[model samples]
Each structure stands twice: as C-alpha cells, then as structure tokens.
Target: LNEIADHDDEGAALQWLRRNRRAKLWISPVTLAEVLEGAEDVDAVRAYLSRYGWQGIHRIQAETAARLQRRTKHRLGENDAWQAAVAECMKARVVGHDDAFKRLAAGYEDYRP
Candidate 1:
C-alpha cells in the first residue's frame, strides 16, 4: 500500500503500514515499485526486509493480474484500475484509504487478506 506520498509519516498512515508488518505481506510488482520508488534509501529496504526475509515478502504474479483485470469495471477511474491491477495481482485485500480503491475493493468479495 505504499506510495510516494506515504513517505510523509505525519499521521495514521505510518501506523497502519507498520502495525502489522510482521504478518505475511503480499505485494505485486507495482506495489514493489511503489515501495522502491517511495524509499529515500535503498539500503533501508534491504535492511528492513533482511529481518523478515524473502519468505515474508510474498510476491504476486500474473494470476492476480488476470483476476483483477477480469473483476475491474470498465468505468473505473485510471488510478482505480491501476490499484485493482496491483491488488488483484497479489490476490491480497487492499489497504487503501482512497474512495476509488475502496469502492473497487468492495466488489472483490472473494478477496482474501
């Protein structure tokens, strides 16, 4: 769920992401891109993940992409589509505060966290 703006941990956003990080986390390539892009230091990611290890970072693949694409509505906003693409790709319940992503998530009743 990380984004460029998420770098600013001035509020609840930071708490939400860090609170349950010990739990299994799913990530699509897009989400990976976001975290990498948002980070100020590359080594921090490696250092942070080193403890959790690769097994903790469950990467999503094409199955998620196709499923999300199939579930996505044609009328959805561009950002929403992208969001769906990533969430769907991971088959992970999205952790988004945005209205659009929330709405899209609503339609994915089968989505598992």
Candidate 2:
C-alpha cells in the first residue's frame, strides 16, 4: 500500500515493482483496507491496486494470524499479524518497510528507501 502511495518513483518499492514486473504480485484484504483508509482518492488507489491479484483471508490465515500474535506475545499488531499470515499462507514474501515484520518468522522483503 505504502509503495503504491509513495510518489517517489525511484523508491525501493517502486524499483522492486519494476525489477519483478513478471512476478505474480498479490494484495491481501488487510492491505486493501489499509490502502483505502485515509486515502485522498479512493477510486484512483483502488484502480491502481486492481492490477494485483487479491488474496482473501480464510480460516487457515485467520488461525495463522492468531498463532503469530500469540507467539509474538501480542507484540505484533493485528493488521501486521494478518499480513504476515496471508504471506505465510500463500508462500509469498511480505514486501514493505515495516520493521515489525522482523518479529514474525515469515518470508519478508524489506523495501525501505
């Protein structure tokens, strides 16, 4: 979400997008909600995000999120846990600038710039 919202085309996230244009990108429901919240142009953001594949949260992801929160002693925020869970369930990497992702034992790609 932050990547798409970032105006810096030279940022790490944008660079990652360019580098892996052929890769199958995905967005979770948690991400969609986060992107929509406080967005100045909801329609524009939604349209841009529509390019990525949507990954819905299921029972497995929910359970995984709960487990992640418990394992982290509730240090992980609810949304972060869900994001990690979705990545885990899909066997995908969590790409973002959030340091909180380091606490979870999931595949992560830090796109900090």
Candidate 3:
C-alpha cells in the first residue's frame, strides 16, 4: 500500500494480487508494522490492513522464524524472517519484490510484478 500510494512500480504486485481472484492474500503483523512505520495516517493504514488476512506471530512462528534465521547463511531483517515463517506456516506464496526472500523462494512462490 505504501508503494502503491507512492506510485512505485512494485505497486503492480498489489494490482496483480487483487486481480487474481483465486489467490488469498495474507500479511504478518510484522509486515503491518513495516507498512505503518512512516505513515502519516496510521489509523487509515490500520483500517486498511484489517480488511486483509492477518497472520499473527505466535510462539511457534517466532520459534520457526528464529530457527530459520539461524539456519540460513543469508542475512535478513527480523520482520522478513517473521514473514517467511508466516509464509511457511500458512503454506502460502509470498508476493513482494524484496530480495531478502530469495533464499526461501524454493519453499514458497515469490511473486514480483
């Protein structure tokens, strides 16, 4: 949404997701924080996220993310690791342009538009 609001080309990913009726969109709570990090209207963003599927970080997911981070040789941010964990838990594909997810690409589909 931040990308879409800012008119980034990567915003096309969001468009593609919306157009794909067969796809189910999901986001981690960490992702919500990342999206709201620099937003001027936090309430609006919060409301927006509420409309989509939210994957909350639980003890299992936290542990999974930690294990994944420890096992991987590649460097990744905390939130990225959490998102990857969420993806693994949901057995769903990740849609984004972040290169940090390359390592997990084989486990889950990584869509960039």
Candidate 4:
C-alpha cells in the first residue's frame, strides 16, 4: 500500500500489521514511487514504514506496458495503469482506498494489498 492507500482510518494498515504481527508482504514499484517521491516527508514516511516487512517488486517492463495499453484500451490512465502493472508484475495486490482504483480493480482479480 502507498501513502494514499493508508488514508483509511488514518493508517489502519500499519495498525493492523502491528496488532496482527504479520510480516513479509509484497509491494509494487508504483507504490514505492509514491513512497519515495510523493510523500509529504520522506524521512517520516520511511520511519513509519520501517515497522513493516515491506518487500518491493519492480513493475512490468515497457513491453508489458504497451501490451497492457493494447489489452485494456479502457483509458485507465498511465499512472493508475502503471500502478496496476506493478501490482500485477509483483503478483501483489493493489491496496488503496481511492474509490477510482477500487472501482477499477473490481472488474479484475486483485487483492487489497
């Protein structure tokens, strides 16, 4: 999950992790991009995420992107589709609270990440 994904209950994912003691999870490069580049404060975000066992995976390559473009043809947009591609590549779920993303994923098979 990215920063936007955690807006649910003001960081509920982390809270859930802390409570359940779960470890070793999948992550996507798109999510990581948000983590490293789009955060309000990188240090604080990193510190907060340090509590979890975050295993990041790279996104699908360019051909995959182009292939996805040809496949979807649904105007999912670059950023969102990139995120989905990363999730798909990692075989991880795209965890997010964004209504749009949720709606997009509803038509496909995915985890909440």
Candidate 5:
C-alpha cells in the first residue's frame, strides 16, 4: 500500500490489489506480523489493517496452513505457507512477486502485477 501510495516502481501490485478490492480478501496472521514488524508507525499499520479489514486466524486456518507447509513440493517459509493457506481457504488468488509465492503459483493463480 505504501508503495502504491508513493507511486513506487512496485505500485503495480498495489494497483492490482485496489482493482480487486471487492474480492473477499484474506490476510494471514503471519503476513500481518511480517508487515507490522517492519513498520515504523503503529498508527499507520492500524489504519492499513482497518482499510483492508483482515480476517483473523482460526484454529482451522492454522491447521490448514500447517498441512500446506507439510504437503507442498516447494520449501516455503512460515509466512508464505500461512498466506497460501489463507488464500486457499478463501478461494482467492495470491498476489505477490516473491519466489516462494511464485513456486506455489502452480496451485494458486498468480496475480502477476
């Protein structure tokens, strides 16, 4: 979002996200944690969270994420696995450019922005 807000080179991803705003988007707790850890302002993070309206992680989601980690042919990090699980559970596409996500793109649609 900051990239989009600042009109950065990587703003294409944020633009895609905005275009799909009406879609039932779901962000994993792991993803949120990753973002918050790097964020300098708590208020900005809170505002972003409110804007996106993230779905909280439940036991079922966590279990499914764990299963995905164990079953994937690619070696995925904790955050990527959880993000993939959330996307799978929601039947949504994974919008990212990370190699880990790209590796899992075969199973999920890659919103190449």
Candidate 6:
C-alpha cells in the first residue's frame, strides 16, 4: 500500500502486487484504517484499494490477536497483531516489509526490496 501510495513501481512489493493482481488477496479493516489515516488523499487511496477483498475482524480474530500479542510479549503492536490475526485466521500469507511480522508465527512474505 505504501508502495502504491508512493507510486514506487520498482518496489518489490508493488511488483508482487502487479504479478498477483488476479490472486485472491484480502485486506484487514485495521490495515484499511491505518493506510487511510496517513493518506494525503483518502478518497483516492480508498478507491485504489477497493479492488481487494476486505475481511472484518471477528471475535475469533480478536482473540487470536490478543493471544499472539500476549505470547509475543506485545512485540507485535496492536495494529500488526490484528493484521497477523486476520491473515492467520484466513490461512493467508501476509505480504509486507515489517520485521515485526516475523516475530509472530504467521505465514509471511517479506517484500522489503
């Protein structure tokens, strides 16, 4: 998302997104909020992100995120915990450059380039 917002076409994350355009990707509500919070043009960003699927946080996901946070000693912050929880609950791979995601036991694809 940051890559897209910055228009970093050469970024590995952006490249991966382009390559997987047809894949069943999903975005968490937490992620949507975070992205929009920092976006200079919220409407544009929202419109751009509308193509992906959105999964709302449920009780199980919240519980999972709490457990993950507790187990990690709060290393995975609240927002990231939610993200990880959503991905874990969906059995999906988390694609991001955040090193903190590595601290949790979730499937992760490091897009740090």
Among these predictions, the greatest TM-score belongs to 6
Q: lDDT of each prediction vs. the true structure?
A: 0.49, 0.80, 0.75, 0.55, 0.67, 0.81
Clashing pairs in 3: none
Q: Model 3 over residues 35-71: C-alpha lDDT tens digits?
A: 8886777787777677788778899888888899899
Q: What is the TM-score of each candidate against the true structure?
A: 0.49, 0.86, 0.81, 0.55, 0.72, 0.86
Model 1 regions lying over 4 Å from their true place: 1-10, 17-22, 49-64, 75-91, 106-113
lDDT winner between candidates 2 and 3: 2
Encode model 1's per-residue lDDT on 72-105: one tens digit a residue: 4644554445556565544555565555555564
lDDT of 4 by residue, 4-30 (tens): 334444465555555546535555455
- lDDT by residue for model 5 (26-113), tens: 6656767776676666567656666564766777778988887777676588777777777777766677767777666555654554
Question: lDDT (0-100) at residue 93 of candidate 4?
Answer: 56
Candidate number with the higher lDDT (1 or 2): 2
- Count of clashes, each model: 2, 0, 0, 0, 0, 0
Off by over 4 Å in 3: 4-10, 108-110
Model 3's alpha-carbon lDDT is 0.75
Candidate 5 off by > 4 Å:
2-10, 106-112
What stretches of model 6 exceed 4 Å from their correct place?
Answer: none
* Between candidates 1 and 3, the lDDT winner: 3
